[model samples]
Target chain A: MGMHLRACFALAVALGAANSAIAETRLDTDALQLEVLAGSCANCHGTDGRMVGAVPALAGRSAEQLEARLLAFKHEENTGATIMDRIAKGYTDEELATLADYFSHLPATAELTP
Target chain B: MSQPWNRLSRRQLLKGLGGASALPLLGAMPSLAIGGQHAGHVVVVGGGFGGATAAKYLKRANPAIKVTLVEPAEVFYTCPFSNLFLGGLRDMRSIAHNYDELRQRYGVDVIHALAEDIDADAHKVRLSTGDTLRYDRLVLSPGVDMRWDALDGYDEAAAEKAPHAWKAGHQTTLLKQQLEAMEDGGTFIIVAPDNPYRCPPGPYERAGMVAHYFKEHKPNSKVLILDAKDNFSKQGLFTAGWQRLYGDRIEWVGLSNDGRVTRVDADNLEVETEFGTRHRADVLNVIPPQKAGWIADRAGVTDSSGWVPVKPDTFESQQVSDIYVVGDATVAAPMPKSGFCANAQAKVVAAAIASSLEQQPAPTAYWANTCYSLVGPNYGISVAGVYRVTDGAIAEVPGAGGVSPADAPDTVRALEAEYAVGWYNAICQDTWGTQV
Candidate 1:
């Protein structure tokens, strides 16, 4: 049983190393985390932040612009909103920065088809 | 001219790669440790918001992970916008979506087969197609099933006669047909279930929508609600909307006033209340009490409440190893069983699963839920919250989210209605990998 456990542990270490190498060429851990975090916004902002209709789209805006808007909402400076003021208060400034950077880097489009 | 490669979305690139044909390569991967195995098999049951989002995010987090989704239906009808369909504000096709994008763009193997049985100990699932599948991890989002025995004389046959329309497909159409067939002064009755049911504000929304229909078409028609609970989600907003738009056309009876339905006589078109009072109606919609889908019970993951308990952070089953449950089937208290909540939970679980495959500790998980209910053609109300794991259970984050303010201006209400439409489109794109 000990021998089997040791073998499994060794294989796990090797696989982890290989994954780290592969992940370097792809999205790093921080970038991936930001991507997942931004998914919560998709329910209103559209997939990849390309919204239609009255809601403002989040993609392709400057990082500073996104950050400023988020901070305003967070600090309750942006009043007369329905759900955004409450939703923005949920995150810290650090998360807001990460989200701004992530969405800013995404391609901005006027509309997206299925 | 050719499109720039950088302009291609992640889903576009995936579909261009012919990923669906690569299923054999995925199935050939070696099955080793549960969370530590690279390119591990993750079988997701159901193709609704929860399971579809989980499958897509799991593949996005780790492209090598194999996700096979087991769902019997070829087309999915969302419960979110279904009330609008009943209200004649939308069509049935507007709410129906196919699984082609989930299969092609996300590399999810969409199998139109019922998951007949789950062998938790062996980590295998038997399908109605006589095939058995092995998985390193299983994500069950089978939603909910009606508790047929909860109400006397309410069964499958009864549902056919007096549709529940809870599952959001043919039953929705059936109920709409019944309403259309009613006389001008006919009575339309809705029997609401107890708490912890899927879409807490759904019954009230249906009532409002039905009232809207009656007000337009049958001016003398009346809509009656027989609720099993004294209070409900967004009660103030719903009642206010009913009073403003529906007037005396709509009425509600709470359980405290003997409104709880004891039995339903579908053939006679009558419902009996707790006080043995019988109310006959031209149209009866009996939404039976619910429990987690039968698959959860068969897998032995559910508690006595007919829902599966899970570790709040990872959504892993508390009773069974190597299995995760989300959506309506989960005991994720403080977080309603809503589509938005399920989508958020799926992302958290996806990240946790990805981290586990690398043998890393699960990361800090946060989730959110927003439910939008339309009261009239141009009016809407919403409830939202942010949640995190605290003291070993899910709890709402303080001062982070709230419902729509009561007695808002018509402009605000109208804007909310537009946002509701936007939310439906956006959520469909997020979950099904395309617009419905």
Candidate 2:
């Protein structure tokens, strides 16, 4: 009975490690794929991508806004941004280029409803 | 109205008029005047747990303000502990309350009229009887309203057939009839709605009690819960109780498990799922999603979300100052919309309205709530919390509240269930001025 309990504990630890590894692999990405992913994103964010509210549609964001957010996620400076980082984490350099191109192409809407 | 009777506190006078003989309090002229100053008048729109307690305590705190209560119902039949009645352990009459004691003992002006409108600027309320009442302050505690349009092929008309029965009255009686007449090898389907609805664990408890009735009477019937949400309020404890007591007779499906009920064809007594699956049952109980009572919307108090927004401490509307919304009508964040919470809020509103009437500072308010959901006979689970106003919203005091201990002994669990019934009776008695 003691041996059975020990084996079960060991199996649980192994499964935990495997799950972490799967999460790590998903975080590695190319920039070009990231850019391609931004097309569907424009549905929520207006052109020029300044978004609104907690679920803001990002349209007309400044170049600085994109760079600051990306760096914040990469360095873990903004810890509560797990969802955003998860979306951006897999991109390669070329994918990032494509993403920037897609968002930058939009026209910015000025008005917002309360 | 000739030489108004001498003023006395409700507790003292009511205790004096014991037994059922003093039930009709209409003739007793109890005035709220103190020190010969003209007293303010407080008008409460509904006589549920919230409005009743507020009226009861407001009179107790100050015999000065003339309190007038307007409720459409002659007697209130509470939704709480109706499950025990369903289980056949308690009688329906035990859940009914009379407002006569409230009128006679507390000297409350109990008017049985539907509130038609509120002219906030004039500080007056219009009733269905074409009569107008001027109020120093107004408290509205009309309980929940069902969203008949939320589901396709369902509305007030169709609900009469399948019966949501969410609110107790004729619908409750109809649902009870369906269960009683159901066959031994029948299927009972309960379609539960999404969040921000009344009685989170209510549908589950109802399922258990009905199952209990079936276990003894029908024996072969089963209950299937088609829930819109994946995780329920007390899932683990409910599952444990279902497994232990009811065996495999009960089943629950969450949203991810294709549990979302999309439509109901009341003609065929059939329910359709989002995946286009149809389920026909011997008894169909659709506890539809709800909103603030319809009057709130008609009065332009509720936002698009179908709930009224209020200043947390005062329970006064964010839109209008003179009007206060309590009970299930207001958006009380960090507090579940339960009868206990409604009672707590009514107390705060009562104090605020009373204080405002005297042109004095409204006292800082505090509230306490304990919600108990019974899973079976002598088996219960609960969540308790104490609340205070912070940052203009009601927030639960951290470290002051918690859910029932995860592993309570059976005896303790039974005690909690008993206490739950007792609490329900106490609250109903306190609010309506008569015990159910």
Candidate maximizing lDDT: 1
* CA deviation > 4 Å runs, candidate 1: A1-28, B1-38
Cα lDDT tens digits, model 1, B240-307, are: 99999989888999999988998999998999998998999999999888999999998899999888
Q: What is the TM-score of each candidate against the true structure?
A: 0.89, 0.73
Q: In lDDT terms, how accurate is model 2?
A: 0.68
TM-score of decoy 2: 0.73
True contacts kept of each: 0.51, 0.00
Off by over 4 Å in 2: A1-114, B1-37
Cα deviation at B76, candidate 2, in Å, is 0.4
* Residue lDDT tens for model 2, A20-49: 321221111121122113322321232123
lDDT of 1 by residue, A1-114 (tens): 223333433443464455433222222344345545676898788777887666778888998999888888889553678888888887777777767766786778755543
CA-based DockQ, model 2: 0.01
B1-436: candidate 2 lDDT, tens digit per residue = 0011332433224423432222233222222322323357789888887888788767655555678899998878878777777777677788888798788877788999999888888888899999999987888887899887899988888878788877776788888888898889999899999988877778888888988888889899999999899987778878888887899999998899889999998888899899977888888888888999977765667888999999886888888777888887788867878787787787678767766765655655656666777878888877666566777678876654556666667876786686566556455644664653
